[model samples]
Target: MDDRNIQYIIQEKFHTLSKSQQKVATFTLKNLQFVGVHSATNVGEKAGVSETTVIRFCYAIGLSGYAQLQREVTMFLFNEGNNSSLQNYLQSKQKLIENPRFYEKTMEKDASRILNISKNLHEEDFNRASLLLHTKKKIFIIGYGSSNLAAQWLYFTLNLLRPKVVLMKLETNEMIRSLQEIDEESVVIILSFHRYFKEPIQLASEIQDKKCEIIGITDSRIAPITKYSTITFVNEQQEMSTIDGMPALISFLNTLIVGMTAQDHDYYEKQRVKYDDFQNSFIADRWS
Candidate 1:
């Protein structure tokens, strides 16, 4: 068996571990070096659990006994320091201890991933999304928590290209007002990422009930919100130690806008001139 697979196994099974198992798992993941040198009773004391719980945690993570767990940690220390899960932003300490240059490596890794996303993007998905944005009667963009700002920026960009584009605001009445405007003819765009906020899921459900078209921008193809969407854009976002991937999402959004502009040059030019006129009158005067 590949002892190197233990870290990813722990991560993938984290949510399913019992409370006591989680306690042991958390401590073990953060202190693999210590586990390699210590006995089960000593490790248990450091993790604030009993030796039996340590043994149980071992079994829970698919190890036969505490000795195997120690062997795995030893193998991890000698090799396999660059496992992908260690690069995750959520598991901060692991990344630092395993690879001190994780930040720089992550930047290069994430940039390459984003560029590949653009290359692999399906033509049909792009055309369908751009066509809908150009023709929809009203477009409502929804995102909550970390995604709220991205949604707002998208709303602003789309509003400039066409009218009746609204960002779903936080207030209860505003949300109701936005939903009231949604129907079969309307289009909704939802931006959701890892640990996706619940509000967007519920909102997607409501929009699905209206039989409106949904455009889902998320990291996974099987993301919950995709069930309600007519078009789904899966732009994978890999989190670093402290930052979530935003550049990739922005790249996708920019492409969407560019596509729309290309589809209707006359309409876009008309809106651009109007926008310039408003900006010049209201904001440009400060330059003088």
Candidate 2:
């Protein structure tokens, strides 16, 4: 089997795919392990498409056949953790640094990914998401695994700007208790990326059940959470590595924060002043 990132291939070819093929693509991206193991007929049933359509989707993405598609999916899943070790990470960084133009290449990649955000994310959705964050009585953020850091950054920054911003803990019982407090006036921001977790998807679904607005920050348009999102920002990564996407995701969040602050400059300014005062008086520890 050729070495290609199945998820990237599917995403790149997604727009050109027929609607039925797109369904298969979405399902395949979301459920790679299932696709790797299941028959075309089973995948078809799960994706709500015909078995023939699933086979065609494989060809549409440049795979030779269903067998090659399965191999690609399996290999991608197996290699997901290949660079996860500290030693491997250090070696990768070392190799990059050995290149004379490493800095330029790295910056170029980051710039490209950040620029792609404007293409994948729509202005109307961005404006609506910003407005929702500013107006909602309560805001909750949920993310897991690799997404946790981004979630925490957003929660901390948002709390500085507004009141009642909750960073939902990962514990199921605690999450359920927190969910009880959400209502139509609440807005939930769910951050999920490739190798997506189930908890955030389920939480988004429940938030949808409560008729609350959801701001989904994800890498794919058909990510399960997007189905429940009131507004979604798809920050598709140019590479398979989650680390490569961090700069773009952070940039997107920074823009959202700027938008929220811009909505009421005076109010946010006052809030920041109060925040500084509170931090200086209560939170800071100084050694003189």
Return the TM-score for each candidate structure.
Answer: 0.64, 0.82
- Using TM-score as the measure, which candidate wins? 2
lDDT of each: 0.78, 0.84
Q: Encode model 1's per-residue lDDT on 1-288: one tens digit a residue.
A: 542245555654565778887878877766778888999998889888899999998888788999988887887666445534335445544554478777777676667867968986889989999988888899899988667767878988988889998899878999999999899889899998755777888899888889888999876554677778889887754342114457667767888989988888998999999999999988867776
Between which residue pairs do clashes occur in model 2?
A: none
Runs off by more than 4 Å, candidate 1: 1-107, 240-242, 284-288
Worst 10 residues of 2 by lDDT: 83-92
Query: Can you write out model 2's per-residue Cα lDDT over 46-140, one digit (the tens) per residue?
Result: 99999999999988989899999998888878877565634433554676788898998678868898887867677788888888888899999
Q: What are the per-model C-alpha RMSD values against the true structure?
A: 10.2, 3.4
Q: Show pairs that collide, candidate 1.
A: 89-240
